[model samples]
Target: MLFRVNWRVKVPSLYWTLMSFSTSHGAWKWADRLRIRRTTVDDYEGVVSVRSDINRGCDYIPGTYRQLLKHNTGYAGFIDHELVSFMFAAEIDNGCSVVIQSGRIKEEYEGRGIISAMKKHSFHDLSRTATRSVSVTSSPFACDILLQRNARLLCKMERLIFATSRHALKNTQRSPKVDQSSTIPADDAFLKNIFLSSEITSTIFPENRLVIRGTPYELVTSNIERILCLSDQILVSKDYGTGSANLISFGSTWRSNHTDVVFINLFGESVDDKIIFEHVHRHVAGKTSSCEDKIIMYIVCTKQQHEETVKRVLKKHSWELLVVHDLYAIEESYSWMN
Candidate 1:
């Protein structure tokens, strides 16, 4: 699904104390002054303002903020009637889990317990139905805080970012001989079987979790359809030598800050380097519009070797490596009577 672009727009340790603040006078004073509530369309400007203050390059919130607000999943925090923090508990895996996304607090409000308070409110609202909470972060401090909360570390992946223009990518020469037949478009039946296959569940996915566009979904029958719906193109690559599925990849496209963005999630430990490039090529080509348009591509790989392979391929294609991030996936499960 393609989303249109609407251009706009954590310190852990002491955080625990702030989150667990009791009914003491001091805590009450702080709690009474801050207001927490579900976000509405009215909060759009405030959300954009808070995001702008952080100065994070190329944010997707401005474009998808409204879409994310659907299902009443967005939440915000306010002090003196100013929106300081915001978060979204996006439902995934057939509503059996929610992956927290776009959580942010103004730079001035960092470590002031604003985010913790917002999380407390949001999770409380989702507690009855959402049995699992999942999040992906590149910040070591955030990872530490999740670990402190007893969230299991599912797996870490290398986030590879590349910046290139449509012209550069289009002009790049293709590999002399790529086994195009090895990769094929994945249909409903193919995805249902591959995603649930025991071999794929144990080996391709990290810890039985399928991380797509930075959100993790457990590899299960219920999640197969959602996964297929979320991705624009799902490709399965086979090893001709062995005639076995060797890699499965998901690609998605959206507009952010006037530039086209393509996100590719690759699952497999043993994949051909050429095939990896081919998958990326197909996604970018499908979205490329003008020669002058800029494109940013984010690729997530579970294996270090795959990361290296992607780097080599991008370099060969004249794509500039922007920055690589060490991303971690954390999850915590809850038990509740149905």
Candidate 2:
């Protein structure tokens, strides 16, 4: 475990003593009312209740919550017997890394230091694991929380193109034809070439080494399958159909937590805005089974040109920009400062 080292003493004792004064004064309302405990199957209903009432969609599915509870590691904070917050961490890379699933607090409990307390409680458990890294994909605000504890930005999730409008599909089909190309089944070689391509290299983690350790081949293949299984087809383009040589783009569709996600996982070779939109429109329109309410499309881009192109083409397609964050911390001492 990472915290097995001598650094345990260095982890500040403020958390334990923060309420000492309140306890001595007999005004320790939180001391007795607020309690953090392991989440159990019996608590599922409460968790879901909190979720159903939340203003935003959950970060994970219901089944995931059950699985985390089974591990006896998922946590919940309750006050007056009302579940107010929850969190779970799932190990990855054979326990060398852990991806924090999600941390949530009910709306009424916000700004009460509930999230901070939950982090301290959960990090204690994670610190006892063989984890070497911790990763989280969250919104900008959530990223800020992770950042306070010494995690750094690995990458910003961007460059997504999506649309579900039947009109958009028709418009795309009739839209000015950029050269169109045939789809190629994604293979290891094809994906590797794209990964090593100068365009992708320049656009991904330009300031960092972009070391996505553990099962690159598996990650890519699984992503491809995620699209194929959720959507009817994968979109691949070569030379942007521009009659040019040595250009490639890859795309797929998937669903997450009841949201329809169209992932343009790979793109470049040529930055044809029309081609990008056309592919996304076709994928979304072709898919008969998407989420009941919304179809969320995403892409990862880091270049000014690609970002601009995506914004321009997707504006008319009911697309909205959402920040995707990749935050990480060391396994043992989750805080880099350690």
Candidate 3:
């Protein structure tokens, strides 16, 4: 069983005495509350903000992000009344993604070492379960947390694409109804279009149903290491379809959390160029399924095969059609300060 290194030290009496004076000493309040409880949907927004503040690279999905967490083991650390510090870890025993999501300490509360205190609580919660493992992305702070906690770094990818597809419910002048609800299953027909049928995907061209509104395809793969990357994910047609490959390299283990299955690379093989990728994107967008939440798919690929990579991804999740994209290129320029 994995556990935290015992790096305990006596808290200086002066610090505790100083903390006693301030009401915002809410960190301890959170630590106290967590002792007898677990986190829930109610604490999402606060934690989301912390996640956003700490990682400023991407957008967030609050509605469905925490939905699946309820089914598995979840942990939260509330500071200053709201959940200022949070960790969303998934269990190895479960089929869900064991993500050690956003962690943050509020601006005013930074110097207090609140993150470590909150992590202590999180690790304690995780230790109760018999699950063998969990997953977390790479972050300097998170790296420290894992190291201090004594968790193994089983595996990691440099650039993981945490992508999801959302039905752009028009929030304009008129109140139009969303034909589909707010969330969809990861294995629905829509996702299947982008994940289940790649072999026959080349048969279809640009005629498949596709959605092209949000993030542009070129921007998605501009930095991805691929041959000819395009911006797209799911695609569908009369008979065959594709997986989230518009901008993805079919399957590159960037943000792949699937514990049981791994995808094959469709780079430089029996793949078709031309409209194959576009066709799959079209089918993925126009397809309908029972899922209601926003749907999105992530792909990683060889830089040389970016453009036609979608043709390979479509063979899998051809049913669960949704938005598709590749991981953002890791900019070495920005890391110099770190």
The best candidate in terms of TM-score: 1
Better of 1 and 3 by lDDT: 1
For model 3, the stretches where C-alpha displacement exceeds 4 angstroms are 1-37, 49-58, 80-82, 94-99, 111-113, 126-133, 138-153, 156-298, 301-338
TM-score of each: 0.82, 0.56, 0.39
Tens-place lDDT digits, model 3, residues 238-297: 212433233222321111121111122222222443333433333233322332334333
**Per-residue lDDT of 91-162 in model 1, one digit per residue for the tens?**
677677777667776655554555656655666676567777777766555577667767789888877778
Q: Residues 94-207, candidate 2: write the lDDT tens digits.
A: 344444444566655554566555655566666565333444332344445445545555555343434344444445455565545454444555545544556554533243
Q: What lDDT score belongs to each candidate, Candidate 1 first?
A: 0.70, 0.47, 0.32
Q: List the residue pairs that clash in candidate 2.
A: 2-332, 158-301, 159-299, 160-298, 160-299, 179-241
Candidate 1 global Cα RMSD: 6.3
TM-score result, candidate 1: 0.82
Q: Sum up the clashes in candidate 3.
A: 68
Give lDDT: candidate 1, residue 22. Answer: 31
**Candidate 2: TM-score?**
0.56
Better of 2 and 3 by lDDT: 2
Q: Looking at model 2, which ten-residue stretch has the lowest summed lDDT?
A: 11-20
